[model samples]
Target: MKAEILYEAISEINPKYIEEADMRVITKINPWKRFLVAAACLILCISLSIPALAATDNSFAYELLYTVSPELAQNLKPVRETCEDDGIKMEVVAASIEGDTVNILLAMQDMTGNRITASSDLMDSYSIHMPYDQTACCQLEKYDSETGIALWSITIDQAESKLKPGDKITFSVSEILSQKEHTEIKLDSIDVSNIIEATEFTVDPQIRGGAGNFDEDSMECKRLLLPEENGYKLCDGVILTGTGMVDGKLHIQCKYDDILNTDNHGYIYLKNSSGEVDEYYSSISFWADNKTDSYEEYIFDIPYDELAEFEIWGEFWTCNNAPIQGEWQVTFAISE
Candidate 1:
């Protein structure tokens, strides 16, 4: 009797706690005496629909932003994510506007990738391609026209991390007022992409330089002969330019001729911004040190910039007049 009484009491309490609304009651809400029921229902429906619409809008905007290149990461560098996804790319070219003015664009593949694609008008604006590293703080140091110095550095924060293979990387670029800093709005795009790998050029100074027009003419290597089409290769001699405000080391790597061996000595020089030839353009010698191949090494520091060219040479003599081949390579880096 006691247990039965407790069970009856619990049933009455559970009913009281139940929500008062049910499906049958909703259908029989006394339609003839309709009150504020329909209005309340309409308001509830609107509230729920708004968030759905906003979510869709946000999704579309993010998609568009990912296709764009950030102007900040100077260079055609898009925020590439190659590990999981292929990269979205844009080619930037220069278009002369007026005197010192130029127009930069975000373009699609024209003569390179596909056969039918024409000059894509993806985006053309009053901008310049500031090719930069998408990695944060990675500023591309444009060579100083006047100084032979390339003392540029960027400190990537902890947030932007070291990359691994097949990782997705996002790049964000912002506006540059103008060439005359703060002149006009330039760009504000965030390019999304991934890099499968990076291609590097570890210069081989000796064989990498232009086949100087000095083949049979003079001692000093010619200035700006042309970018080597065949990459670094041993030749009769070499002619090329160096970079820096002060003399930096230049390394020439070549296969050591074992038989008779070879020897020649030379020096490098520079032409200053004033168009005057100088031994030291920017505290660095416009230098040349040509000599017969003793063993085979790389690097002879010199001061040079775009404005000033280099004409370095070894003793106007020839050694084992054969091409320096093998895994010979060159390396040029700043010391100061």
Candidate 2:
């Protein structure tokens, strides 16, 4: 079957149901025979009730906000505005204004049966304008292949003087580009020379920690206090405390002696044994609740078996992506 024909069949079903069908189809057929199996699965899924699938609302923003802060979810306002052109649809699902920040959830779909997504590159292709002068961050939260739809979360930090309560901000997009025209840079082209500096370190295997709690008794925790010469300082006073594997994920912690400095920020990257970069997720911040020493933790989703063969790299940069002058790499190795 042609790719477009297969996509059309898949698009008839709901995105959520397509996930289970995708898994079953993948497991049942060989890699070369995936298209045939996908077509068969799509036919089976379409026979079911379309209204039942439509009843389930799988909004990524709804789930994320509810999970993190229910109060924020309660105050969210729906945005019924949508823009469509060139076989592409952009829907402004909802928006929430909290203090100095306004969060907007957008859903984009490719109606041309293409497997394109609202990736960062695609977002960069368009210009988003708000009512006020603000700094914005856009993250592609989720993508549904079945429907060729992608969900995005955009947060805008408005100046205190510019934004007030009961103010509705109007957002507009311009210069939208086709996804096919976007050129993706290969991973090999990433130049890291002088961008980061790294040193090798090991974590003892006997140490362990429960969910959300660090094992203080573990040797890993003790090593967090390594002397200045052995440890890497993320900034002038921010120290890379320790590295460890917690619950099959690579965990690295840092101590920020100077939390008041807003300019201090950094990022952590992972490289596998093959030199290819691995995708990892982390949340780093400068604030700590009622603690004398503020800390930041980076956790990479890596399997235990592959953790031993991986290396961790750290880079100190301003939040705006400006390079901080210094060597900033800390490699990791698991010691038996």
Candidate 3:
């Protein structure tokens, strides 16, 4: 019974519905029919009592803050700062602050227990100041090297000093850059044919940067041909460069040739033209690239006259999470 051991025995019989179900329906079942439908849903969740269905729908903190910004997962506020130098230990647990954006949910440890790795190249050494502003532009929506934990988001565009709601935010980490050295690489296959190459784009909607920024003025930019598989090399090419349409949302940028350490992993999809496949509304918006090393601007709230012809693809995960196999794609058209 191996679908990863029947998903670890359905995560030990209903770990919050195997952590909120739908992992593409558990990787398209068929491990002995998903272990007889996970042993008949673990014998009907042990004759219906899984803690009374986790005490009536708790959505695991909005499914982990909806993987970042499902509108900042409504009214969240649970903080308990902690710190410790050198051997690392930091924590910020939770936070939220809509408007000028600011969502945090950090956690790090190694206090000598050893087993660390949360480096997206140390995420620019982290920051979120407010002793008088200037330094809020962090974004690494999720990382969990088996639980060192991370989910940051800070965007204070300073529209005349904004960030009020009992403001006292100061989540600085000065330096992290961890790695106690752990290596485990196992792969039987990951061809991805020949990476990918085929592009198209057309869209023009504009309003430029102000008054709510609704720009798309004919988005066109594409380039993605990364794949040095087997010998492993997940980046050294990936560029879709532009596309934006605020307010009604649908941004697409994608530039990465390096410096996008994993744990925020990556995978994008959106197939339409009647094939209908719009995985979870999309959401990712990292940044840090003065010329390579970071660029992920997904974020599709959908609504660009309903996007006509679509076909996006995915693949990105290295730096230990491994899964760099890819034929990442692209296709788009909407210029009636």
Best-matching candidate per TM-score: 2
> Worst lDDT window (10 residues) for model 1?
327-336
- Steric clash count of candidate 2: 3
Instruction: Please say which candidate is ahead in lDDT: 1 or 3.
Output: 3
lDDT (0-100) at residue 322 of candidate 3? 29
Candidate 3 structure quality by residue, lDDT tens digits, 214-292 = 2333222222112122222334344445544544555554545444343233434566667676652434333342432
Per-model TM against the reference: 0.16, 0.35, 0.23
Q: Tell me how candidate 3 scores on lDDT.
A: 0.39
Off by over 4 Å in 3: 1-88, 91-109, 117-135, 138-158, 162-167, 170-318, 322-336
Error of 1 at 156 (Å): 57
- Model 2 is weakest, by summed lDDT over 10 consecutive residues, at 327-336
- What's the C-alpha lDDT at position 294 in model 3? 48
Model 2 C-alpha lDDT per residue in residues 25-123, reported as the tens digit of each score: 111122112223434433322221111211236455455434434444455465545656656667666665555555666666667756344432232
> Best lDDT goes to which candidate?
2
The candidate, 1 or 3, that scores higher on TM-score is: 3
- lDDT at residue 155 of model 3 (Cα atoms): 40
